[model samples]
Target: MTEFANPGVGTFAAWDYVVFASIFVISSGIGVFFAIKERKNASSRAFLVGGRQMVCGPVALSLTASFMSAVTVLGCPSEVYCHGASFILFCLAFSFVIIFTAEIFLPVFYRSGITSTYEYLELRFNRVVRVAATIIYILQTILYTGVVVYAPALALNQVTGFNLWGSVFATGIVCTFYCTLGGLKAVVWTDAFQMVVMLLGFLTVLIQGTIELGGRGNMWKIAWNGQRLNIFDFAVDPLRRHTFWTLTVGGTFTWLGIYGVNQSTIQRCISCKSERHAKIALYLNLLGLWVIIVCAVFSGLVMYAFYINCDPWTAGFISTSDQLMPYFVMEILGHLPGLPGLFVACAFSGTLSTVAASINALATVTYEDFVKQCFPNVSDKMSTWISKSLCIVFGIACTSMAVAASLMGGIIQAALSIHGMCGGPMLGLFSLGILFPSANWIGAIGGLAFGVTLSFWPAIGGFIYPASASKTLPLHLSTNGCLPLNISDLLSTQLLNFTSQERERSILAENWYSLSYLYYSPLGCLGSLITGLLISRISGPKHTTIVRPTLIRPVSDLFCFWTDKGRKDNKEKTPSDNDRIIRASAEKELNDVCIQESRKIPSIYIPEQCTHINVLCVKETYF
Candidate 1:
């Protein structure tokens, strides 16, 4: 066994284990309670979406906890420590994404009343398109959840001397059990409890660190003087990472894909009793996101303040900046007995909430989109059982992937790359369906395939041939207080040589790989959208039938104002009259196709007004 030089500073005591164990016990108990309560009604819908009766508050908190994850809790502080505060601008972009998601994406999914978000693809395009989108989402969630599971394990390993694999398996098995037993109800309630623990732990560190550092004023002064208070970097270079444009513009598309189109966020929203309540939950989620961001950022500032003089990196206490947060926690809270355990519990909670959410969402899309469609005769009880089994299977898969992820470098970048790789293509498919009525299944598939290929090329290349592009920040840190003169001289010389080495590559390779990871999602979305649109125009419109109004956003209709004057004049008609003309055209085409091809087209009733329509307004909804 590896021994710590100072047990109090680097190892967990008996009380610490007690506090951490209590969290697992309580979380598992909640699952048992819900499993017993809902045992009689074990339908697929109830298992997946909680019977559409989840309240606004807990669901909102659950969404927040899921999105925050261990990635945000641990990664954000490290980001601030290493890169500066430019990342805080993501909050603004996230707010815009929330508004867009609420007004555009949520209404469509909630109004359609679909079990899986990808079902909209089948309705708007084809079954092939739906399956393609579902596969992409599953791949993305698995890759991401693995990284989420690995983050806490890696951090705990550094401070608590616990085996990394032990942490990973413990977290994975516990999360899988509760999610499999109680389903979404257990996941949401446990997430709410975990969210509280997360906040309390963060606030505890912030308040305690501030006092130790002589109050907030001194902490801010020290951080600002050391050049760690980087807020707005207005640089306009796309290749330069973490600038204003990257965080705001690039971040908007990234977050839109995450919150707007991802099934995890959509599942929580649709679980609510009404669209109104879901909207309320979404807004509450925005508030929670901001709070979490602030806490993470401030924690970074606090870490900087505490280490302003005695730099941990130079002193050789830690190997990477990612380990800095846990190191700081153990250093400051070790003497307080259960405090270290509480902090570990907090990190574990983040990992658990996120992994549980992902596993549950993955099972949902798997069973609803694939298994049920493939095995149409499966009963509801059997289907629910399949979903539960799937939850366990995916949880195990994620745990295995977590072992692989441990060998990877930079948790934040790895997680975001995986998310962008899949999220972009999935978002593109939805955007094509909702924004462009002319897009066909051929175009959707082609676009997604091409987009995914482009996104993954850079990711795989970077992983295989990892190269560092930027220089480390020149923050104020001195070894005068912690290191002897001779050792300090050697350390400074080694750092100087490392920084001064030449990074040489061909111009083509440099440009290709130099594209900031932040732009990956936006590029993928744009590439897929443009490709789909072009292919659709080339292939001509396949669906001449009346497009469902709920599938089309009203904002997209505003493009009608910018059409050529001649076309607009010829098409001048009231909105209701325009709807009638479109319907008549669709009817004519349907009759002609039916006669020519000798095939029957399903008929459905629709309202004259778009605004008054709901899921009930149309029957035979799927083509």
Candidate 2:
């Protein structure tokens, strides 16, 4: 490892340490102030959802930070390093999903008047589906948070010489403190600060790397000639790693789990002041992610250029590919005035921000899904306390998992694979709730079980089916690990690389960019949608009216017909239909009671779906 440099205690510059320390202290300071403010408004709903008054700027920035975690900063660079420019093109596939979400799901969620996004499951299908989706989210959050927690600490340990576990706990501890105290408000505010520091630190490294590598032109020339910049390989091979089809499809599915179903992203959108403001937040967030992703991918290209002949992983400078970016930063930029400290702090900030956001979302799910529904009489104060307590516990659990991640090499691949495995099923469950109106409780539950079981296969062992099983069916693995990378390369060379057309076909066949990450969203979404529909059809439609489908427009529109017609049919004076008379009598009694008690309660502020004119005004102010 190049005779590990001993940064002597006396030689350690005060200014450099101070620069990194300031970023952490300043970020925590913002979180602490907000935590104090949020504690004052300790209503259960307010603590979890920020009283639904969050403006666009904070929401946009926080969402950006939440979305761009250590995964984007570290894993993406590794993806580009291993696969090349095709990973960069993968980001574009998600832009359309973001657009669809802004127009389709955002409005429906706002109108539904629920705090947690999983509430849509209860309102649409049944409590079982709601519980199923909530559990999947909690499971995914823990795994995802563990990765975000582990990767950056590994990087920090490489750069700053801190204990691996110590760095993970230290980062998790600060995030837990403010997140537990301040709630969503604190997480969002702190994320805004973290996002700024993260970008500045990365941009510093990128510019420095460019300068050290001669310039942008030199970097690209080397990358292009070495086949690192190739994005298109028009071969129709299923075993290929990154094809245009896989990139678009897999990338879209992967992001849908993050932005569409994950509570971390949903929490930000729900906190916005109005529906239009939420869409604006989402739009601005997509734009920011585009910029951040390009920068991250470019960072990888620069790393490739810097170490083309002497690849760090192959040369044994670093133990794994994920360490490539960290080593590159420390090797070239470590000697700069304060740049090393800035990048190290940024790396930790990415981990901390994501863990904090995930912890907060987990707490919200616990309170809303399990506590409130299970124990309907808990007081607001106690409920808020439970939420805070859960955050503390989950934070500790995630820290333990992060420490464990060190022993398991290929941190990026492990983290991403875990996400795909856990997140794919969750996305499927949500799709069933939003897309299929007739998805009864039985069907929903069955689909959940099936999806969860099916997604775990690739993680345990590579693929189970025959090599040429499905036509044009790209080989996929849920977890990204070194074992699979070695397997894929070996198999491709010895078996699949034989054709005169195949070896000279395209570099994409050799690179890891074969199946783009975008397809994960559609695969998961449609997979669950079909599963739920088939199950519901087999169950033969339950007699009772299912919960209202209020999250997505099409499902809600379809179910509204049955619910409305049933109400109208019963309202008619038809004594011949004895069932109708009983339903009408029950409705009359409920309406009378509702009228008698209407004047006693105060109304809460809830944002409503707006008209085009109001939406325009909201976009102007929010954006």
Candidate 3:
């Protein structure tokens, strides 16, 4: 039998190069085509939101691709392999995420008709809140984009001998080019194509691996007997990594922050032709996310079963768990000329989709919130050019950040920690706006500042002073029957030593730094919400008495208790209050008329219809 060694540089064949190169060429071609197609009407709105004429199918696929970054592609399988299938339980949270996002957050942003999600903060609170939220989002996206790009590049470097930086630049530049020139339309379409490629590649590896492991039944039996099929770890311990509580309850808040208020997702939702279509896209995205995650989980089980008698980690074939997926691909499909290349293409596809979405979203929020506010009179043509330029600039910044991420210990942990830090605070601010009507701007600003500080403290501390040992649970493995005698000896020497006192810290240190990262989003969100409520109560009520129904939760309409209380309050109003109520009723009437008209009209009929209706209603009310 032949001995196995770690794959070195130049491990990938020429056909593999062809497959990888094709992705770049096709992605760039799509960008150029869209750039030329929309050249005549290159307005900021068109570029940033695809003219708000996007369909549900492509938008849904784009959302799925954007959310399923390289971290999911490379890290999910590794997670399953290392800690069993408890990670799969997180899939349970997707439905809740979709429902909450659609029912609560989508209507608010869709009704507001804002280009940037951060704009909601400005409308509900003050400019200070808007600017703060934008900055936080920008930081989060930049950091997260780097980690997304880095994950696949690191895997490629390990399996194919490709330079990590080379892979990073290649994916980053291609994504930026398409996103810059093609705008949101190009980004969404390419993302749809990439998602298809990713699934094809993943399934190819999974099917081939399962067959080679003596079919699915044997594979499952081996994995189950090895304790790799533990799907439900119902432990309530927050300190334990993958429990039912962490995966379900904690995952709900994590995904809520991701799908609910993140600019990338909000942009996709608003880009749809109507709120109905956006909801369809969100549900479709949920389905797609589930498919990709299931594929990853099964691929992990296949890898574990294949390597049962030949542990790669014990044999020193790969340095990190993230490398396991790519390593398994090369080992199983290396002989099938183009398959390895397909796997590399899949990884790059995920990275490109994520980075492209982020660059477009970043360019969008930057242009709309900061640049356009200063230069509101800039022509649409000039605005489009400026937005494209911002895409390129942020693309370079993200690539540099990707370089920094390469030095980090774990891709999934680093990416999620960044998300929790920024996304949590941003979600908190929006939650206060949507769920709590009395939360003022002063409260929002103060709560956001405090929440950000609280999240950053733990994240930075954990990274700087990590535990001496990792906290991952072990999976059963044996190498006694391996062909190579040396591999068997290596496995024997590395006897299972799960006893490590790595996390035995003081109570204070444990509470602060050892807080499970899963709870970061919830904690930060609750921190912001509680703080905002307290501060708002202390500062007393705001001078303005009006409450926009669209800006708050729609639960008032469903609960008769709330509706009855609202009616009672309305009856107690003074003459001035009655006049204001009459104006508000007129505005609502105008909105209803506009909605009815919009349904009958073509797509071209609604350009800032909400804004126009507000203007007409105000002019007719008091004049």
For each candidate, give its TM-score against the true structure: 0.88, 0.79, 0.87
lDDT per residue (tens digit) for residues 1-623 in model 2: 12322222212256667887786687678767876776667677788888889999988889888868877777778777767777776567669768867765666666677778887777666787788788887877786677788877776566457678777777888888888878888888888888998899789878999999899999999878867777876665534546676666666776777777778888788888777788899988888888788888899889877766555464334666677677777777766767777777777777778888888888888888988888888887888888889889888877777755665445555555566666777777776655544456677777777776655643443221212213222122111222212233433543453443344534433332233233333445566667766877676644223233234444333332325543344222212213311355554544443334322211100012223343233223312
List the candidate numbers ranked by TM-score, top first. 1, 3, 2
Best by TM-score: 1
Candidate 3 lDDT (Cα, 0 to 1): 0.79
Question: Tens digit of lDDT per residue, candidate 3, span 162-215?
Answer: 998888898889999999999999999999999999999999999899889889
Q: How many residue pairs clash in each candidate?
A: 0, 24, 0
Estimate candidate 2's alpha-carbon lDDT, on a 0 to 1 scale. Answer: 0.67
| Cα deviation of 511, candidate 2, in Å | 18
Question: Which pairs clash (backbone N, Cα, C closer than 3 Å) in model 1?
Answer: none
What candidate 1 gets wrong by more than 4 Å, as runs, is 1-10, 467-477, 486-503, 543-545, 558-607, 610-623
Full-model lDDT for every candidate: 0.78, 0.67, 0.79
Displacement of the residue 147 alpha carbon in candidate 3, Å:
0.6
lDDT of candidate model 1 versus the reference: 0.78
lDDT for each residue of candidate 1 in 101-180, tens digit (9 for 90 to 100): 99778877886768799888887777888888888788788888888998778877976798988889999999999999
**Clashing residue pairs in candidate 3, if any?**
none
Candidate 3 or 2, higher lDDT: 3
Give the poorly placed runs of model 3, Cα more than 4 Å off.
1-10, 467-470, 481-504, 543-545, 558-623
